[model samples]
Target: MDIHALKRQGMTISEIARRTGHDRKTVRRYLNGDRVPGVRKRAEPDPFDAFVDYVTARLNEDPHLWVVTLLDELEPLGYAGSYQSLTRQIRLRGLRPACTACAHVTQRPNAIIEHPPGEETQFDWLELPDAPTGWGFPTKRAYLLVGSLAHSGVWRGVLSPSMDVPHLLAAMTTLLALLGGVTRVWRFDRMATVLNPVTRDLTPMFAGFAKHHGVQPVVCRPRSGNRKGVVEKNNHTAAQRWWRALPDGLTLEQAQASVDAFARRQDERPRRTETGNTTAKAMFAAERLRPLPPVVFPVVVAEERTATRQALIDWRGNRYSVPPELAAAKVVVQQRLGADTIDIATTSGTVVARHRVVEPGLGVTIRDTGHVAALEAIAMASAPPGRPHRRKERIPPGPAALRAAQVLTGTGQPVSTVISLAAYEQAAKNRNTLR
Candidate 1:
């Protein structure tokens, strides 16, 4: 302010320096502004700039690809930036294209819905895309049933094969056990499997399930997902943080264990409560969740599977051998409540084969010796005794076939077949003469 202000006021450096009792170089240095304040500058170039082309190309490839996945790709490419820095740069540059088809952004009034202890729990289905095809799962989308305690934000998830009624209930039952207990009211978002979407009435089966577990069912208003905000946040967290980076070649059991561990670890993060900052585990311990039922609800999971040419049926990533006759046939697969084995049945409700359940997605092939023996016996019984006829062999018509053709044609014309040697003899004579 002293020297620079004096100079900006039209005073020379020598004049300012002499006035301020300072040297001329010092005044010039001040005028030069080596240490100016409030002027933003980057000390060094961003490392992320070196990888902008790579990130931009990747974003164009998959607009919805997770940032974590991008980070994973960038880590080995000599990019030494943090995830936040990478995301910020990507956003600032608009590398990721906007999805016009899925523009569901709308602003609405939001109110915090306070959940009392032991009052409620929210449930939702998270459909994961690009599921592991090697798992032999029936569909490309993987379904996870997530349940969260509204008060403490403690949540758990279970991966299921499908979103049908029985599978949904079975997964919900499993989630209840994983969550430690059941709450008084179970909140849902009008999932068709659980209730009527228009009527908002629980299905008879789901009502029975609720009765069996002694919990109330509450359906949220249409499109009001934030009514169950706790579970909604958890859904995003699980998908972005955990599911995006799932390791390859993991068995279904291993994946479930991994997610369960992740959820349990999340309970230790600090949470804001009525009293003050506390942990989810501490608050959950104070929740008054009711005990689960003595036995799981009778939700028999049944699915239709097709037998392959090798008489094998695909079920939950494992192949089970059926009778050879059932090859190229449709069969029913059923697993009863509390049962350790899975049943392969006929359309007529007859159980044809049973195999003990194993960890899914391990690519295990279960075979019954009886089925194999039957297949071999049938194959041998129908075996040919001699070598197969040549595919391109000439089979000229014989006398019997000629007579049959003449009789069918109502004619007695004699068919002649000969190879003339006269032409060859004449050709040989011509060659001899030329020699």
Candidate 2:
């Protein structure tokens, strides 16, 4: 409304006053038309908008990708942009550069049916790399067998050598026996060991393992980790809490034991996914898991081998000498690597030796002839001295003196003559100086 502003804006003071319906003096006093009210100038359009969405989607699809790699991909797609601009746009959008793509398919209305207590559970195996085993010297790479109740999250996890059908079934059977029942259904991935190597059209759940528990096997679609997402997520969580939670220098057994204890605690804790309901309590309420029959399966996997009388039982090339009881007789070798200490057994399952398989080279050479004499010799040496020695001290003959004496004394005709001469010196001295 200032007259100076109105004049600068090309409106006369009188014209501004008329438009604003204010007096000429007021308009002249306040007018400054160089500035507008209540409006801000817009910024330039984003430079990378054409590719920002694509870049973000690619990152979401594969979280492990690097920014440089993503930029390279964008370059080929007509993205005429700098890395800095792309980086800025990503930040401005508050994007997580490493978020996995969430499958947009929502859970069907009744996809997850809550079974009564013990009704159903899911199982899977997660692989880990070679690491040191605490108890023994050999490094052990292991697979974790994880089982969770669909409703409660009541779970059990154990480690096995690999996902071989026998090992997998053993782990499952052991876990189920410990839990006291077979759940109505078991969910799992289509691992070749468990699933009968199903081709494109055929569906084959593990016949042997499935028959043992009498639980229907539900397999997830191939390559769809999302379909079996619960245990998939848990496998990662277990890796974080169980695998990474281990002390930096712990051996594999120590790490495995630590992981087992942690998994138990995780099972006992209230599940955040279940609105803070303790899995144990929820599991107790769901009676869906069936009770196992009185029959229990053997955990020690057995293999048949012949033992030659001279052929030492070389398991993993470390020899174990079985008692003569099975010297030439063929025996059943029940070798288990991680669960328990090494055991040497006869054909009748008699434990011949219960030594732990320590280093890769420990030999259990059980000989028929006892080592009592050798042991006694060692013991005698190690025993305390009975008394201190009391011996007369004598100076040794000098090398020059001995040479001069030998030269001055001519060589005797026979060894007897030389001995007799030496005896004479000893007799004259009344002490065996030469001796």
Candidate 3:
């Protein structure tokens, strides 16, 4: 159209058409003011017009009814329209009502946090899918206790049989020891082992543990796992990147070792940080962690039990062997939090026995071979060497006489039989002669 004005300004029609890349006839028509823009006409009326009212009514009744379900209903009514046609018409008519609830809710923006070196560590539990146990059965529900240093993104994890207080503490201890030091602050979720769900206060045992480590326990707000986001992300990373490919038939010990190896590999990989691209191992080298205490916190649940005559102490329905000398002695069975072994100790804290803890209801007898050998020695030393004298033989009544006695007893009659000692001795001598 601009070429029309160009033609009026003394440019030839061929020149205008060639410059504008338009046909000469089109350019001439535009100059003559006879060309009109083409008008758009509607395509064939949609085949879905007959059922528009039905869909609109249903959507008005329940806006959430799926478009495919409407298609199913229309198909039975002899409507031969495809799903796309029906959805297109429905969308054009705005049949579905706007969901005000979802529209009003807004997502909160995530703030990037910068953790100073050795300042904090985040801890969380990751519940993994059922995996094959050492027994080759897919029955064990494994949970991994993950701890990550916030500054370095370096993490360590341990598999726990449970999320109870003992398991939690044991896993934490193992992870911290692997990391070689503790952070100033231990950030955690509202786990039952650490905080009371109802009161939202720290548990007494966990408080003691925290105090012993010289760390401040900072609990995330209820339902706010993002507060401890490092370990939370690590949870997913470990499950997807490491646990997913774990070999079949992994024992608890093997799984733990695998987790440790995976953590080491992860630490060596390079990661992006605010400072620059660096490996977690590199950052960890610069971290100034608090020195570990001379002794680990005593995070054990203690129970008192008396050793059985067989020198076996019973705990949680399982028997653990102790020294034979400790038989019938009252001893304390101390199960460290999250530890797989139970310590059998005296009241004075001297450990006399240690056995791998067995699950309840197993009725297992965990015997130390040494204890068995010692007990056998003690038994051998106390037993007499030779056979004792045999008692004098005595002859008894025959089956017929015994039956008669039983019948008489059933009749409530007082039945008795007596024999002289000399007569019994003579009968016994006759039997021996026959033999």
lDDT of each: 0.86, 0.62, 0.82
Flag the better candidate by TM-score, 1 or 2.
Answer: 1
Candidate numbers, best TM-score first, in rank order: 1, 3, 2
lDDT of 2 by residue, 187-252 (tens): 787777665664532233346446755767777775655555656767888887777655666544
**Compared with the true structure, what per-residue lDDT tens digits does model 3 show for residues 1-435?**
477578779999889988999899988877776766563334787566777788878887777789898889888888887888788888887878865544533455767788999899999899887765442222457788899999889999977656888668878888899999998999988778899988888999888889989999999876566777788888999999888988886555667778899899898888787668889899999888988888767777676777888999767557899999898888888886556899999878899999988775466899999999999999889989886556885658998788788787795455579766998899999999999
- Writing each residue's lDDT as its tens digit, candidate 1 over 233-282 gives 99999999999999888867778889999999999989986679999999
lDDT of 3: 0.82
Ranking by lDDT: 1, 3, 2
Off by over 4 Å in 3: 1-107, 135-139, 301-334, 337-435
Clashes of each: 0, 21, 4
| Residue 54, candidate 3: C-alpha displacement in angstroms | 12
Ranked by TM-score, the better of candidates 1 and 3 is 1
Best by lDDT: 1
TM-score for each predicted model, relative to the true structure: 0.62, 0.51, 0.54
